[model samples]
Target: MGGRAFSLNTPPIRHDVYLRLVSKFTTLLQTLHEIVRVAPHAPEKITHGDIDVLVASPLRTYTSEEPIALLGAEQCIPGFPTANFAIYEPEIEAYVQLDMRICPPEKIEWEIFYRSYGDLWNILGIMGKRVGISVNQAGVRVSVEHIEKKNKKAAMVHLTDDPRSAVEFFGCDWEKYERGFGTIQEMFDFCAGCRFLDVEISQRREKITVESRRLRDLRPLCQRWFDEYLPKLMGEEAGREIELNVHSREGVLEEALGKFDKRLDHDMLVGMWGKDLFDKEMWRRIRALLPLGTKRGNIVVRALAKRLEEADLGNGEYGALCESEEWRREREANWTEIAKAEWRVILAAVQ
Candidate 1:
C-alpha cells in the first residue's frame, strides 16, 4: 500500500485534534511562503483524512525535497508538478497524508478554487457539464475552441471574468464565486438555490459505489447536502423526488448486475474475473516477464506499464491472480507479438 492506506477500522480524528495538527502544519508552511492556502476551507466542520495545501510562488518549479527535509517525511511519492508526503503527527499518533501542489502565482486563484471545496466543486462540475462549460485543473472553458489550436495550450479562465454567465446558467451568487464562502451554510445555500441540484445529487449517489477512497470520504457531506439541507431549502416534495430517483437508480444497477451474473457461464465467469484481474495487475506482471535485451524493449515495457497505471489499472489487486498458471501461459504466449506491435507503432510515429 501507499503511505496513506489505513485499516478500515481506523478511528476518525477528533475535530480539535485535526485543528491542532493543521495549525502546526500551517505554521511550518507559512515559514516557507506567504501564499499558502489550506483546503476544505473556512467553516466546514468535518473530519479530514489528509491536509491539502496549495503553495504558490513566482519561481518556475518546486520540488518535494524541501518538504521532505523540513517535515521529516517518511515517504515522498513524486507526482511531477505535485507531490505527496506522509508526515507523522505526534498529536494523532499516526501518519498524516499531505498533498502539496506547487504552482506559479498566476494560477493560485484557480488552484484554490479547484481544490478547496470537493463536494461543491463536484456539484458545480455537474452543472457545468450540463451546459457545456468544462471546469477542470486547466481552467474553466465554454468549449474546446477556447483551447489553443496549434499547441493545444489553455490557461484557466477565471470565473470572475464572466461571473454573470455562470450565475445565470447555474443560479449561484457571483459574489461567492469571486470570494470563497466563509461557512458551509453559504455553500449549502448556493447549491440549494441551483436548478441543477437534483442532477448533482443523482450523479453523486451514482458514484458512491465506484468512487476512490478520497472521494468516498465526501459522501457524508454530499448526503447532508441532499438529504437534509436541500430538502429544507426546496420543498419536501422535491426532496422526496430526489431520494426516489436515487433509490430507483441503485435498484436498476443491482438488477442489471444480477441478470448479468445469471447469464455468465463457467468459462465466461472465469474470463470476466480474469479480465478484471488483468486490468488491475497484468501490466506489472507483463513488465516482469519481458525478456532482457535491447534498451528499446525495456523502454516499451516501462512505457506500457506507465500508460496502464495512468489509466488506474496498473496495480492494487490480490497477488493470487498473478500466480495463475493459465494467466501466466496466456501472457507469455501473447507478449512477443504485443511487444513487436508496440515497437512498430513507436517506429512509425517517429518516422
Candidate 2:
C-alpha cells in the first residue's frame, strides 16, 4: 500500500509563524475587496471570514466555470492581499465560488491569471538542489542551488504533464521513483543473465549464477572490459591483448544485452573452458552468416546445441566416459574453477 502526503492545510498548522501569517491573510483579502467593485446579482457575502479555494482538480484554476469534478483541499487564504483580483483558468470556477461566498457582495472589478509555484519542494514533498518550473501558458525554466536538492531535473521529468499528478503518483517524492527504478533495472539485467546459468547440468550453477550477476552489474571500466574488449581477444595462446573497442561485439549476445554491455559477458565463461570452444574469428564468421542487425545469440547457440545433442550414435561402450566417477567429478570441479577465474579477471579489469 502507498501513502499520501500532507498539505499545508492539514489541520494543526504546525508552525507558529505560518499560523499567524494565515490568520492575517483573511483580513488582507477583506481590505482588498472593499476597494474593488462588486458585480450586480452577486450574493452579498461578507469578506471577514475563511473561504475555501480549490487546490487541485481537473478544472482550470483561473478561467473555467465548469463544475468541480475532483475535489482537492479547500483553501483558507482569506483576505489574502491582491493588487487586483485575478483567477487562474483551471481554478477559476472554485475561486469564483469561494470569492462569492467570502468576499464583499460587490463584484471586484479585476483580472484573473495563473502563476506556478517555483518551489518544487513545497509542492512535490521533497527537496532538491535543482528545480524546474513550467506553465501551461508559459514555457519551461530550471534553477540550480547548491543548498537545494540534487534530483531537480528528475523531479521535473516526472512533472512533465502535471506536477500535481506526478507528485501524487510517485507518492509526492521524486526520490522514491528514482530509487525504485534504479533497483528495478539492476535486478532486471542481473536476473536475465543468471537465468541462463540455471540451465547447466553441473554443480557449477551457484558459482555461475554469482558471476553472471556480477557481470550484469558491471560499471565504468568493467562494462567496457566484458562487453567490448573481452570478446575481441583471441585464445590465451594467441596472446591477443584486450583493449576497449566500441565497434566490436558478437551479434547474438549483443542483441539482447548489447545496450547494456557490447556482448554477453557470461558467454566468455563457457568459451574459456573447452579447447574446441568458439574463438573470436569463429564468432565473427557466425555473426556474418546471420541476417544483418540480428542479435539473438543465445537462441542460435541453443538451437544448434539442441540439434547436435540429439544426434544418433553407434552402439558402443561410449558410456564409459560417464562410468568413471572420478572423471565426472573432475569435469565439474575444473569447470567451476575456470568459471570463477574468468569472473575474477573480469571483475578485476572492471574495478
Any runs in candidate 2 off by more than 4 Å, and if so which?
Answer: 1-49, 52-126, 130-141, 144-165, 168-351
Residue-level lDDT of model 2, residues 72-156, one tens digit each, is: 2233223422211222223113221223222222212111111211111221211111112222312122222221143433322
lDDT for every model? 0.56, 0.28
Q: RMSD, each candidate, Å?
A: 15.7, 27.3
The most accurate candidate by lDDT is 1
lDDT of 1 by residue, 94-198 (tens): 777777777777767766666656677665665454333445665554322222232223311223323344354455776775676767788777765554445
Query: What is the C-alpha local distance difference test score of candidate 1?
Result: 0.56
Question: How accurate locally is residue 32 in candidate 1, as Cα lDDT from 0 to 100?
Answer: 74
Error of 2 at 118 (Å): 15
Best by TM-score: 1
